[model samples]
Target: MGIEPKNLAGWSDLLEQAVKDTLIPSMKTQEYTWDTTDIVSDPKRLAAFVALSSAGESIQVGFSGEPSDVASVVSQMFGFDDLEDAGDDYSEILDGLAEIINIVAGALHRSLSSDGNNLQLSIPLLIHGEIVIQGKEEWVAHRLTIGDNNIDAIIIRGLIQKQKD
Candidate 1:
């Protein structure tokens, strides 16, 4: 199941807090417009697009990077290290990336649903093959910046429905 529209506003607010409390502690926060895009088929892939900038500059923190590095940063915030060391395996690195996305999603879910109701989240699917974001024109991407990254961190939230034949 996906997130409902009525819950998105609260979700976004919670996400902002999660980022500040869990990811970037010294970063400034801002509210941007919320928008949606078409849902992709890949289950490993979470969210539509993510853009995080540090110190007003856009940094390319691709999933191809080291899992240890990612885990280290994330673990520091969450206080638990569930990621396994996979050495130089790219697939393992991708798995770590998916985990990070999941963590972020879970944090959002928790922030939105204060009643402790269960929020269903799809398994983290890898972004493979050809995939195009449908309804790109309808999306309002929000960006937030931290540290020296010139570009702002982006958060895109939208209601996604399955395409009918």
Candidate 2:
């Protein structure tokens, strides 16, 4: 089994901490602060999703926000005054977003592995549209506000199963 169902909340809390701890201090922009964690839909234009799997169970993490906000984050992460400085290329922006999710997943992976959860992380998937969650799937999403930007981090437990015909 993967993370126990009863321990999901605790894991989610840890995920929140991972995001805050990873971004708060290292970010170039200092005005950004921890806002709140709440259940929210995917309203952002860009998103990156990664998953951790162990013993046939999986936990997926998705980080999403607006393109401008994502660009801001990429700029901050790379120490660029603006993403435009790195060139106005769109693929670089997407890669930067993937890297952000990769960093957060790395942190979470270390924590969970330290606790004896032999988990393997999957490649980060970048999405440009909406994220749809099927019925019976457990989705725990949080809204994190940094400065004036709103980012959503979603945690999905269990594998997605297809309905029978």
Candidate 3:
């Protein structure tokens, strides 16, 4: 099962802290500041999601933002002096996107698991378009700013699926 609705706020705070503690520094830049914001909108953007599970409970975390902004952060994370140094290929950009999520998710996993939750994480998946929800899972969405980039973070609590006997 997913994290309960009642605990979502606390978990949201943890998630935001994880982002601040992990994502910002990993960008390898000092100009970026992390702060809560409204959900973002960009016609074309880059996104990634990672699934974190513990025993019967699980949640999905996602990060998405405009392509240019994401690419800028990724470039900085890679220590590239400029975007061109990071390459112009789409696949390369996607890989960079996946890498950042992996870093953030891995850190989050370690923190939660340390508290005896024993969380496991799926590989970060690069996605296009919106996150699709097929069940009645409770979720929380938070938008954060990294410098001028507006990135959206989504947490979708898992719903336990029963098996037929």
For model 2, residues 31-143, the per-residue Cα lDDT tens digits are 54443465434434677788888888888887777777788877777777757455435577778889888888899988888887888999987776566667678777777
> How many steric clashes between backbone atoms does each model show?
19, 0, 1
**Which is the leading candidate under TM-score?**
2
Q: What is the C-alpha RMSD of each candidate to the true structure, in Å?
A: 11.0, 4.4, 5.8
For model 2, the local distance difference test gives 0.72
lDDT accuracy of residue 18 in candidate 1: 62
Clashing pairs in 3: 1-56
Q: Give TM per candidate.
A: 0.44, 0.81, 0.77
Candidate 1 structure lDDT:
0.39
Q: List model 1 lDDT by residue over 1-165, tens digit each.
A: 233333334445555566555446522333222233332333322222233222232211112122344444434435554544544443544554566556665665565456544455555544422233346423222343332222222333422332221
Candidate 3 TM-score, C-alpha based? 0.77
**Per-residue alpha-carbon lDDT of model 3 for 1-165, expressed as tens digits?**
333323767768877777777777766444544445543434356677788876677787777776777777777778765563454445666678788878887877788767666677888777654455545787777776666666778776763221211
Off by over 4 Å in 1: 1-11, 25-89, 116-118, 128-131, 136-138, 143-165
Clashes of 3: 1
